[model samples]
Target: MAFSEEFLSELRARADMESVASSYVTLKRRGRILTGLCPFHNEKTPSFTVYPETQSYYCFGCGNGGDVITFIKNIENLDYVEAVRLLAERVGLDVPQDSRYDAGLFERRRRMFEANRLAARYFFKALYSEAGQAGLAYYHERGLSDAIIRKFGLGFAPKGWENLRRYLNGEGFSDRELFEANLIRKSSRSDRESYYDAFSERVMFPILDLRGNVLAFSGRAITPDAQRKYVNTSDTLVYKKGENLFALNLARKSKAGSLILCEGNMDVVALHQAGFDNAVAGLGTALTEQQAALLSRYTSEVLLCYDNDEAGQKAIRRALSILEKTTLHVKVIRMQGGKDPDEIIKTHGPERFRALLQDAANDVEYRIMQARGAYDVSTSDGKTAFLTDACKVLADLQSPVELDVYASRLAEETGVEKAAILAQAGQLRKTVSRKRERDRLRDARAAAAPAQKAIDAVNPERAKRLRAARAEETLLASIMHNPDIFSQIKGEIEPDDFVTAFNARVFAAVGACMQQYGHFSLSMLEGDFTPAESSAVAAILAQIPNLADTLQECRDCIRVMREEKGKVGRGEACSLSDSDFLKLFKP
Candidate 1:
């Protein structure tokens, strides 16, 4: 009961690349093609191009190229099936339910998701129940209202190991499910398995995914003397610490042009309660590339709302590196007279916090201010060092306008001439460019040397076959890219008809795509093929010279391979003849 090729074809047919891509990017008509900035990565100029005739898109800047399904998969951060389902839902189509899916694995994952959902509900109920009086009083003291508490699914884990264990068991859930879900830990002293709640005597905030499914939870201790201030669920099948952002389920729905990224659950909850519903927090971990990609999907801008402390400043720098790779416009929110966002809101109210967000400086300007605060700029040596360091930071700015403005600011702060700072910035830019060029050349040489070695080691007979196989791979990839070629050469070729295993897989995948989608596309074959096959196909497509002229080239290569086989059968040394070699090199 594997997914039928016909169902996939229908799904692909229903998914319009132009329509799906336009939802995330501002696509402009460009003579039978469409152009837009790549939503996958940051760029001031548009390098993401879509060809409606081919139903494919390729980002020249980042090298992320694929068809409609690939676009949805990357943009939505979903797996192949999930992306297919999402697009299917969008277009009012049904995903064929196949019986081949592992029922046990699916049920176990569902139970885990269900266990978390029920536990969150129970925790919320406990906060309002008579047994949660202490927790309720703690929230009241902190000025949190019922609305805020309920909005965040604020819950109290009663102070006992068996409370949740007994409750879930009484509700007919097996003990194994609880243990597997990581909701309870077993006691090490007694071999007898007992359920110990993961979070106890703490306020809980349910962490959700972009789809609004509860993936995990984070709990903060109410007791002042509590040894652990915060406890988060260990990574489970559904939750990866580096991949999820707290409250993104709600934030992505906001009309706010940017996201306010905070450091803690309370900070995110507080900001949301204060009408900044676009705020989200990382899972008490450094921001990651995966998380940055997730943020880039909802909005093109982000404000790093870390605590106003030394450690917080360090986290901002780390976040900057990750965010730099994405399309999100980034700025750092620097709080004054408060240690964190929650405190800032509590002490001065939402208006003050909003003002801070509005007045927040760009990362470089913020770093300059931080540097000025860290060192005394009154001395000539200190001022010179500060200006030099600040200029280097400004040079990293992607925009020329931003760099120029920040350079002028650096000059003003250090009482240095703008021309001097600009000169230094130009020098740094040249150095960076030279380093990049050198690295590129080094990589090219490294790659070419290996292929050269492979060619050198191969005997004439094997080398001829390998070259022929390579040509066939390129032909198959091109046919997959534009399947009209498939019909023209259908009778002459079959993937099983190829000799090499790698070539056979490529042809098989192309045949699969053509049979399924009526046209073969790289995106449609994403999860359908093995990684090695995908890489081989990509390499072939990328390296094949003059794709339009390669049809006859591939036919000639196959003919030469056949002729060599004939010579070997005649008890001769297998080699390409003059006429065969001429055909291969012919225009």
Candidate 2:
């Protein structure tokens, strides 16, 4: 439902833009604006600027400009009501129960979360039953304790197709809800039920959000030689495999100072059970940029503890490339005496695992070692090639001391001069800098294109009437930035005069906000517009002109819009000069 303006205004006051954004981004104050690396997209330089004075933000790199609610909606993948509710709870304000707002998707998502919660409970209860003996035995054989199983909400799916379906139905969830939650599947056979369980005879690992809500599950077969060893819940309304990591709910709270990135749920569980409470793994997919950004919010460092296999090494390298763009410090843990973290903990004990973590190699050291393996350094040609490859790795180091130390190490190992290695690394750094600058300029130009700014996905007419749309956008932006100008352009422009539907809606919303709140504010638009619409509105507001020609700009915009709207019907509007159009508008 739509919140009252008073409630939203209060919420906005309580949850300011700077405070809300600082939790996810490390923002630094520059005069009145706070700047930081945008969490929405990966970038080295800080283009995400938060204006505390106006309680808004805009990313110059990406065209994502919005208020605090918009920031939360985009960063957390939440809808308008969900984002508002999250912010409301933060400041201890209860969301109103008014039913004016269309909260269809939000209510559906709430039901989906509830269904997943109930399904997780049913699976957990089934794990202790006689039907789950094989699954329980598998966990025990893998050295997972009963307490750890309960801690992680580990469960089991019985060896039938309709077990979870029947259970959820008994819990008042319909077949459709269960299916939408990805807990059951549609049946094909004539004699079977309409829907059957999605997972069968497998050990269920509940994947939860950071708030401890069960979003989905990953199931592993109990048998050792099963054809399909693992099955994960497909992407649904509440869960996305690539966007979420398993066990982050508990890992984010660890005082361990760093997160242990594991290869699988079992490995994360094993580490957590062995007193490493900060272990987390991806949800049956490779580490993604979203997952890496999520990790950076909770910890300053990430230790890559992949298995000691070729596949694990490759995953670690891929993860390194993803995390390189973030500010998080990275290190790679080399598993010894076993294939994976679980096997190593079982074979060498937690103490040995601790030693392995302590002896973890920094990313640069690991890369250098990896490069050394590709060459025979004993030969002169091999030494030169290895040095060349090592210099590339060293060039990425940000610390001068680290560069010097690594350069010295490379010289000692390859019989090359330290100065020569440093010189090569410096040259590589210059080349990288130039390439990065070029890419940044290209991205900036693309973002600043007038076509991009004027085009609206919801209103295709904006492209057909590009000139009018541009003028309408400028007028709306000006009125929002300076509400006093609303009086000057009061009778000259109306929402109906706008050439595009989307911009018309925006004009009406801006007028309504100004009338109701005595100011142009984003809080009133939270539930009134969709998230995309809200983002587009914020982009418009970010175009506040520097020159104080509000009256002239508004008149010109109204004249253009009038002529354009008239031209849609009559050919006489094409013959009207600027002065004649101005006479008609009378701004």
lDDT of 2 by residue, 347-444 (tens): 99999999999999998999999999889988888888888899999877778999999999888877788899999999999987788789878877
RMSD of 2: 4.3
Query: For each candidate, what TM-score against the reference?
Result: 0.82, 0.89
- For 462-567, candidate 1 gives per-residue lDDT tens digits of 3556655555645665676567767677677665455455566667767766765577656555656653344334444443343545567656645654554454
How many pairs in model 2 have backbone atoms within 3 A of each other, for residues 3 or more apart or on separate chains, i.e. clashes?
0
Instruction: Give the poorly placed runs of model 1, Cα more than 4 Å off.
Output: 25-81, 102-106, 170-172, 192-195, 397-404, 426-429, 436-466, 482-484, 494-499, 512-528, 531-546, 549-554, 560-587
For all candidates in order, the CA lDDT equals 0.73, 0.84
- Candidate 2 Cα deviation (angstroms), residue 429: 4.6
Q: Once all C-alphas are superposed, what RMSD does model 1 give against the true structure?
A: 6.5
lDDT for 567 (candidate 1): 47
What pairs collide in candidate 2?
none
- Which portions of model 2 show Cα errors greater than 4 Å? 99-103, 189-193, 397-400, 426-430, 446-471, 496-501, 523-530, 544-587
